[model samples]
Target: MVLFLYSPLVSRGVAQSPLGAPRATLAAPAEASFAVGQQLDANLAAATAPLLAQGPSSGSIVTYIAMLSSQNVVPNAPMTEARGVVGAALAGDRLVVRGSFRELSSALRDYATDPVDPPNPNITSAFHIHRGSPSENGPFQYALEVTMNSTGRGGSATGDYRLTPEQIQALQNGLLYVDLHTTRNRGGELRGILMPA
Candidate 1:
């Protein structure tokens, strides 16, 4: 019976324990198209010139933000405290992906993604934006570039790359999703859907 009381972990929240409390990752900038825990300030001047410049006149544009969590991963990821939030917006011909995260098990692999309804996929390099539904896994379609960090089991990912009109639509329709891959879980550790806000 004493052996049954034994445990692999020192206990949750113990500093020396491997599965201890989560550490802080880089903070995601507050001034983005959208974000977690807060909404854009109600002010006209808040609209940055660069974002406004890429308005509808500059072809189709998309701005989205969502919370990432372990629950969203398809086939389910091993239980982890890993979580984060992501925001995206168009800048010129480039699409920027930015997010802050914490509690990853190890170094990140690829930030896999899925986009719906794009014909002739071209994204073969950089981190990819893939095509899939909330309940499905799909192929990569667009590219993104961002540095990932894991100091203290947390960091941020930021990248920019060109996106297509059809890809933008996938985001709008909530048919696309973003996920983070880690060394321990190459498939995905955290996932978030691009549903309309």
Candidate 2:
């Protein structure tokens, strides 16, 4: 009995003793709309010319500062705090798909799950949320998004595309819903909203 016990123990020890810890493959974080975790003091001012062009109203400046700073803040609890995909304002004609993730596994989850409501029939490209989904209210316009590409900080999206403008006299109105896509899955997600530029 003693020999058998010792043999098992020795085998277990050998099994535990490996050459080294297994090395995990790390995927790069998605490209950020702007530099994240970065202070918007000088760099931010230099980067956003559109904001600069709007003139120096205090409210405008304050809003711009808030927008830049909020990129680093954590989101409120109960959202997909786990590593997942993130979106950035649709810039130019293309949308960039990005995420703030520590590992590739986190970023990929967004792509696998049913993120789009009414279940996007065509998930071959970016997914879309249904117009009747709980997110929409009577006449308010919501932004629509689509993931086009990715990089190190996060990604980009194109949206707020006006299919039709809300006319004051019209009874029916349309709003934009946010949407996203994934290029490569990152294993984690970040906490925040990516507003349009």
Candidate 3:
């Protein structure tokens, strides 16, 4: 009588050892796929393309865009229906700011004084870029200082300043913001967060 012993490994198609006994092969450990990571990287590149495109060929550049509004101001200052668009571009080490305003309060125009004035009241409305968010009330290091027109209905400003890498990174991370200041509200009448374009 002949008796045959069958091993489970042999049934699963595992190879036999030198002694004719089936051997089990260890399975590889599972790893997280890199496909998801690659997708996330692509998405981030797409979102930041507009801002990075402003950079100069010799060096890096970053761009920030903002919408001027009263509701974004710190301490919640009330303002007229004035609104504007602000654009800031940092190329190499130079930072450039530009913006246009509209529907500004008449009080701002009244407060604004010409340089010829005897007292020379410098109450001109101006634009500024602060280091922190709208709620944080950080220091204003870059000033656009755009003067309003006679109508107080519209104005524009352009200014440039030197910026370090840290400051540029802050701007890229949304840690910077723009503010519109008037003589009536020296603390800033309107504010907006700067974001990548």
Clashes of each: 7, 36, 0
Query: Which stretches of model 2 miss by more than 4 angstroms?
Result: 1-47, 54-61, 64-104, 109-115, 120-188, 193-197
lDDT of 3 at 6: 21
Assess every candidate by TM-score: 0.59, 0.27, 0.59
- lDDT per residue (tens digit) for residues 1-197 in model 2: 11111011112111111113332222233232232322222222233333334444412221111121212222222223223323321222222223223222123334336344554434433323223222322222333233323533233322222223232112122122223223332211232223222
**Between prediction 1 and prediction 2, which has the larger lDDT?**
1
Off by over 4 Å in 1: 1-50, 53-62, 90-94, 110-128, 149-152
Listed per candidate, the RMSD to the true structure in angstroms reads 13.8, 19.2, 22.4
Q: How many backbone clashes does candidate 3 have?
A: 0
- Give per-residue lDDT, candidate 2, residue 180: 28
lDDT for each residue of candidate 1 in 96-157, tens digit (9 for 90 to 100): 56666677777665323532235244533223456788788777655444455536466665
Write out the backbone clash pairs for model 3: none
Lowest-scoring 10 consecutive residues by lDDT in candidate 3? Answer: 9-18
Task: State the lDDT of candidate 3 residue by residue for 1-197, as single tens digits.
Answer: 23233222211111111133332322222122212222222222332343355543535444555667888888866757666666555556666666666666643423344222443333333576779865688875666656567776557666667788888788767887887766566566778887754
CA displacement after TM-score superposition, residue 68 of candidate 3 (Å)? 0.7
lDDT of 1: 0.53
Ranking by lDDT: 3, 1, 2
